[model samples]
Target: MTSPTISQIGEISLIDDIRKQFSQKLRDVTVGIGDDAAVIKPREKYLLLTTDMMVEGVHFDLRFITAYQLGFKLISVNVSDIYAMGGIPRHVLLTIALHKNTPAEFVHMLMNGVKDAMTLYHAVLVGGDLSSTQDGISLSATLIGYAGKYILRSGAHVGDRIYVTGSLGDSACGLHVLKKMKRTVSLNKKNARGSMHSFCKKLGAMHGGPARSGLSWKIVEPLVRRHLMPEARNPQKFIRDATAMIDISDGLLIDLTRLCNEGSTGAKIYEEKIPVSIEMKKAAECLGIDPLTLALTGGEDYELLFTARQGKRVSATCIGEITESQRVIVNASGKERPLSVGGYRHFQ
Candidate 1:
């Protein structure tokens, strides 16, 4: 007989499996999964909770990223969710599944990365589980946080101005650089060692790095790290002054669409106003792709995009303004173009 999939097993049966695996329930959880809802006691009235997952090959490539960096990035992304709401991240529960043959050292290194992130953000790992997978590694992280006051994405009004933290598109360009580097490394495997080294030196010197007859690791390292490791934005201004806000996880345009959807509004952003980093500029020039295009549609930025009333600003560039009409548009050189919905989508 063919083996049954999750649909065949059914939701209740899957819940039973979960209950069996984690039978030791916490004292605070008065009710379990069987009831209408799971209950827990909280010291504070306001609660913030969010979960994020990362999968090998699909979400990340192990060849370019280390276990520690991977762990750090995963937790940092979750923390960004809380920070976007102007909350303080406090607790995390992590679930990790990896191949059975994976080394204990690798696991330890990954946990060490997690610990580093928790310490950095003052978050504690309350609970977790481990499982064996047939192929690559997968991780699920649930982060809980709180705020005395928090911001929502449904409060933006027509007069509000849109702002973005730091620059955009660095991470996408970094991914591009890494892919090029990967291709170069693969091609080097087929070439003579000396010629490969010479070619690498020439490529490195193409930028303004020192021509020491060696590869320039400096020029490309920033972009690569931007992809492998990114920072979460947690600013008080987002909560205190902004009408609505969101973190840039799914490209600028898509996330902006979400924000507009929440508020039942639209927006118009300037092409030159969207910030692109220097490294991204150089890399995009080399790749012959418009840097602004990368900034608009490339996701995983983790920066805050918020709408605040103009002149109520807290050190941010006014990229655009919320519109009463229900369509997002981008303006450039006295011309206007309808914004495309082409961005990172998990299912589509």
Candidate 2:
């Protein structure tokens, strides 16, 4: 029998089909997949669960990525969600659906990546499922975390200062490299190993470090390898003092807009104060792309965009201030202009 088309089944039906495969366990399960992850009540803490899925073609390309990098990235993305809510990740469960021809060695390498990440983040792999598929590889991880008091997107006050972590746009640089690799594959196929090594060298030179810094080998390699990995800013402690918080999954402008929209306020972001990485700037120049736009609209950085009081006791830098109006503004060249939320829209 032919498989049902994604359009015919729709997202909800597809979710239902997948949900039916799991046998319900555990009592006091207040919520499940519909919201984010499954929420189970503990004796003292509230568990926030979230899961993310990555597919080979749609989410990442294997030609430029190693199995280990893929494994590490899978956990990082899910961990970012927990951090966004000021939660500490406690455990994770990973499910892999691999093509029948996929080598067991490759799978082991991927698991090694997962193991490395768990050790780095101090999270445990409680349990998971494995299966074979006819199509491509798919990895899904369910992350369980604990929060004393959740910092949500809906808690921004009117006078909070917007802050973000780390420099932005490196992931976009990685994506550019992947696109170049795909186009040059035919000519460079014979020298694939050499070419990829050179590409990684260039990427490292741009970033000023080898992709992996020992413990972060899995996490950083994918960012340098395929640009498919998301960052986990791990802002649990930072968000504890924040008035509002959000993950930069949809780019700075878009995710900040979500925070502002939630609080019914506006902002004045200083273009000069925005953090853009050196590697990102070089990559943008090489690709003829605007660095600012990449910082503004490039998605999947996975950094935290949070808000706090202007003089709050936190180690956050204020890139912008909250305003009474409900529109975002960019201050550049001593002139202010309205900023648009033209960020990555998955459906679009």
Candidate 3:
């Protein structure tokens, strides 16, 4: 007889069955699995902890990504949370559920990716648990860091200006390029037979066809890498002056809306003031999507968004200002329009 699948056992039962697998405890981790919550030893300095989840199909596509890249991204994303709060990450706890048939080499590569990212940020993987699942792979990362001072979104004042580090919309544009290129390739494969092959090839060329132009891959790979491996901006000189700060996990509009709501203020962002990279602009042009719109709605740039006074000399763009009113507004050309929060939402 075969063992029952995790779905058949239900979540609670599954947890109970797998909980024993991670029975070992660290000295600092006074309490481990099978408790209301894990407890750790008290520390004198300020502690920072943040968690991030990535579902296989929803958040990433394994078709074009390596296990290592995926692993790197998982750790990097969690670290971004720590940095967003003006903290430095020190440790990570990774949990993953995957099909039983996943190769051990794959797991090794994934962990190697995690190691690669941890090395970059100077963090460590202290502990975590693994479980089997019938569904696709799912990963969650809990990161711990510390900071001398905590920067909260509620710290923003009405007179503060809005700033963002690096260019926006590149991640979203990269996603489009990857997905469209895959579809174009798949469609061509399905239709590339006999007389219709030439016709399909032309259509594919028009729609993100890389086979016809070697330059296509050269151009798009960097952008796709941006999506796969987003960097967490460092909190350097700007942290001292920033009243409030956040990482752009969701689109700019939604994340900024969160900052404004927390601060009990409105915001006025200038459209032209939003930064766009030349590569991102090129991707948008090929896809016929407006780069500015992507900047507004695209999520997961992993750059810093903060509120500061006008005189600071940090390497960030002043995209907008905090308003005393009760609504978020965007100024473009000569017209100003009320902006609504748009970007990645968990559920529709």
**Top TM-score hit:** 3
Task: Give a tens-digit lDDT track for model 3, residues 166-218.
Answer: 88988888777666546322212243244334433453478567364322443
* lDDT of prediction 3: 0.74
Question: Per-residue alpha-carbon lDDT of model 1 for 19-53, expressed as tens digits?
Answer: 45334455544554445545555545578999999
Per-residue lDDT, model 3, residue 76, is: 83
Ten consecutive residues with minimal summed lDDT in candidate 1?
183-192
Model 3 scores worst on lDDT over the 10 consecutive residues at 183-192
Model 2, which residues run further than 4 Å from truth? 1-44, 182-231, 236-240, 343-348
Error of 2 at 107 (Å): 0.8
Error of 3 at 305 (Å): 0.7
lDDT of each: 0.73, 0.68, 0.74
Ranking by TM-score: 3, 1, 2
lDDT of model number 1:
0.73
Give the poorly placed runs of model 3, Cα more than 4 Å off.
1-44, 183-204, 207-215, 237-239, 326-328, 342-348
Tens digit of per-residue lDDT, candidate 2, span 1-348:
544444454445534544443324434444543444546556336788899999989887888667877888898888888889888876777788876566545665677777767667777665566676788889999998888788888777767888988777667656666665563221123555555565555545554544431112222234353354444777754545888888887688888888888888788888888888766665566555677877777777888899887777655556887777756555566677776674433212
Taking all chains together, each candidate's TM-score versus the true structure is 0.78, 0.74, 0.79
Which residue pairs come into collision in candidate 3? none
